[model samples]
Target: MTMTTDTRPRTAVQLQTNGMGDLVWHAEYFRCIAEQSQGGQVTVIAAPTTMARDLIGHEPWLREVIDFDRRPRNGRRGRHSGLDGLMRMGAELAPKRLDRMVMFSDHPGRAVIVCWRAGIRTKLGYGATWLQRLLLTKAPRIAMYDGPPVTGTYLDATAFAIAQGFCSAPLVPHINVRPDALARMRERLAAWSQPGFALSIGSSEPFKQWGAENFAELAARLARTGAGVLLVGGPSETALAQAITAGIASELRPQVLSLTDAPVADTVAAMSLMRACIGNDTGATNIAAAVGTPAWVLMGARPPLMHDPSRMKMLEGASLADISPAAVEAQVLAGLA
Candidate 1:
């Protein structure tokens, strides 16, 4: 549906309760809102996960980041707890008296309720559900096709908001790393004056992860070229990182450094410093791309077209194992060059 730009709101809230990759995808959406509002206040209502905090907490465009703790509490955990949590969240938000709301989540029923109860006059989101179509003041229909980029699906909501005159700017996904973080990363890696590459080996699911052996071989190949390798991931993947680190030959081990469980800001800063990044189709890879670092993403299960296309070289197969180490090494070498 076409919408005329009318009723510029003074304050707007965005609802995004997904993972880090999704947060990176919505960075453009958030920027569009800020631009259209002409610096009007914007807030993000996100989940309480560490990834959410890391992705949205430091955004300069957002005025606040509210942690919408949806985990079942007070014996309220059940199949119906989602609705219960929504009502409670709405009650909590009603006091804010927001002027507008934009939702990026697929589950819009609860968000629609929240906007209504919060007394937000203008609501915008994807009309994927019955409640969404009935409750949202302006919701653009999203059709899922086989080959469309997932980033396109995300950007469509921004386009809708812009078309409606809620915001007036093009979508640009951005990440702002503090100078101190960048300085610290440089200080830590100063010992290795040569250019470096980031190796991200973790994914939200095991199916999406390329085998550790493959990563080990790739790291060995990169190390042979005298490029420092930074193994990146969360604490949960420490074991995997160690295994990959151990797999590298002793002569090349000095060039491979494991940076497991680093802060998101530091990780992003480190990625920015790298010549290029290679990893599974994971949030860290997305973060790397957002920071202007070229990434070679290994894809499994999902199609390559589902992700952002710019500054990325995707290697897809039926499984991560199907992507051989030699193919990844060639791409890595080309990316580094």
Candidate 2:
């Protein structure tokens, strides 16, 4: 991670978000600017994933979060209005007079068009998307992967960006376990937490859910092993939590911590206290990894490369969605035991 200083230090913004993990990975490309850049500013703008901001906005180093839902990137199909959004971004960025811009996109189809509109001279990003590659001053090709703990690819990508000379900062994962996230998690768990707990199994996407009955069975087994089972999710998951709770044997009910009513911020924080979390492939898994909480994430047929592999509590599991309750429970035990 070495670079010749392009003095006249400029404002750096990473524009793109494929997911929470993607946002985390690319945002880190400018971590030094957040910590060491005396005058550089870091802005993360994306089309907004459901809870992506929870990870970035929480960080003090990041200055602004721009999310536009109605206007999806449309420059690719030849519709020019999407460039209008980029123009807006350009106007917003114009005042600062950007010295160096690195768009952490994997060949952003329409975003590169916007970057051009914004007038960034030294654009650095993955050279993907056919029409857009010409826009990059330094756009490298990307390799594909399938594994757990998504942060790895992101880390690799950033290192590539630096090695290629787009950026002049050292690469570090740079994800600090959010202090407020930890406190909120602990406060929610204070009374209900037991010796051990298997985490809530839910995702914002319907396809990501492992059956609630299976989740309940895992909880029952963890309870038998002297661990309390916690069900963590947003309101959408209450029924699943209830079903998991009802299905578990009455004796283990006391050990079951249900906090679907708890605010999402708290749910994310609460994950840190769990002995180990188990869940389907989703944002919660990334959140769990960010907090250093041991977790067994069921990729559920999705490629493993989609999540961070290093932070995983357990990487051994079936790739299928209907991973047996026993299979997940075993991984949780392996992580905890």
Candidate 3:
């Protein structure tokens, strides 16, 4: 392992490189270390895919969210891959003079190497492989464990932190939307009399998406209860949003609002106002659940996205198409009640 003679601060730094949902899923663990244990903020070195800056930039527990170009993927070499990128990343991190680095990733070797090169005195991570064990400064003795990458891995990390006397408390998932964004969402929803429910209509893949027809049926049923149905997604899902709105009964069409074009922050704010969210397995659903809104995730290709029954409920089927809108609606109604 590499070493540096420069004196480093005691502040702990976390290196994470996952998507938005994964970031949100592990929020509590981050808080446990930064707030509960350190009684101060921790800096986060996050990947672009995590959107850490946009999602949790305002989190009080974080001192900063630094952008980290992740390793290569899809047969193309990334800017931060191999020896050259590793050296560059190390140089960049050296300025922080970090003493401790915690890595939460499936590929722990690269992160461990980078921290070593940066001269971080202590590097903590799960030694899932031989390379990780050889490189990591400290790691929990994890028994044979196979579970969801985001939730299960974090749970193990939390347990390790507790056993090591790093943090005493176990935190729960909590998301904070910008006050301005929340106000905007509140102002927009005020125009309607009915309470709101959100339908997250976006998915990373076609097979993961619950079709427009299914959402339309669910929206119409929820609308009959006099609740406003907000169709939430990104710009790419605008057509899908429109299709779902069109599928609704003509009389209740006014109850459905399209929010596909809304900014991510605004959509997150809107989620807080919802009675509940029925979404496909997507980042939006995770965001909704993190914000304390009950989210029913329609699991198709992916089963058991996370392990927070208090906020997230998984509805799995052989395929996304197999899950009926009626069954989803029933779950949502029950959750709301």
Candidate 4:
């Protein structure tokens, strides 16, 4: 509330310290907001994690990253001794000098407190929990069509509208891809005469895993048509990815590659290389779409309305839980050919 809305060349911080999916959605909003900032320095001050690094470092817009991992442990709810973590981070920051500060969290439980402490003023956010609304100068109800509503009331639906400006258009969530990164991936894919595809059959959440046997069937059908396959996921997914590779050992397996890392950059790069990507609703699915690979994202349990469109092939559906692998294979083969 201290920083004025001036056109000064100043620093801005986007605080998105929540779930990876929410962070990804917030990143897209940050992208649009950063573009309008002209040449100001932009940074992401998130809890230290691999996902934060991949997003901030790989994002074409952000210039800096600050880790305030201990903020959660600073006070009430936080398990740490006191505000040592808070003070440690405070010593690093200088106050009230920012041009603007946008608090981009689905729900800013206490994330707003950190922004205020760091000398941020111009707060922007969507849904709030209790004290959250008091922190933002502007809070818009973002609106968008997420297929048919799960409930009759918009408030009751999974698709909540976070409105912005005077525009009535719904937010089309997306992740940005670097041209240089894309150039490298494109060159790599060029080695093969046919366009390649990515398949992800893993998730941190056990319920989200779509199983390897199902993927193998889809991989085989794509191979028959000449599209190469690359499987990417977490290290724990080795057993699953291996099973998939073995299932298509006759031909498709040789074309497939497996990669896993906590930050999982190798898998992300693999996702980018594919002309088309198919997978269960999971981190890699988001990574593929964020990196610009046109995807046929498959989902199980979760609904499709939860996904963003920059990486999705234009289609009509709410979630991929009902998605058949053959349906995805047809889309992949056609895109590759």
lDDT tens string, model 2, 173-256?
Answer: 335556786777676667763765656567656666677777888888888877777787768788888988999889888888
Sorted by lDDT (best first), the order is 3, 1, 2, 4
| Residue 81 Cα positional deviation in candidate 3, in Å, after optimal superposition | 2.7
C-alpha-based local distance difference test score of model 2: 0.62
- Per-residue lDDT of model 1, residues 1-337, tens digit only: 5443545564555555456776776776676676555244477776555365566566667777776666533455533247766777777777766677777655666677777667777777666667667777754565433244546545565555565565576444557776777899989999973688898888877677787888999988888988899999988889999999889999999999989867887888899999888898778888898888888888754656434567777887677777888888886676666
Candidate 3 residues 260-283, lDDT tens each?
A: 888778888999888888888788
**lDDT for 105 (candidate 1):** 59
User: What does candidate 4's lDDT look like per residue over 43-110, in tens digits?
Assistant: 66666533666655677677667665644533544321146555545445545355456554455534
- The best candidate by TM-score is 3
Pairs with backbone N, CA or C atoms under 3 Å apart (clashes), candidate 3: none
True lDDT of residue 283, candidate 3: 87
Sorted by TM-score, highest first, which candidate order results?
A: 3, 1, 2, 4
Ten-residue region with minimum lDDT total, candidate 1: 72-81
For model 1, state the Cα shift of residue 45 in Å. 1.1
Q: Which of candidates 2 and 4 is the stronger one according to TM-score?
A: 2
Cα TM-score per model = 0.86, 0.77, 0.87, 0.72
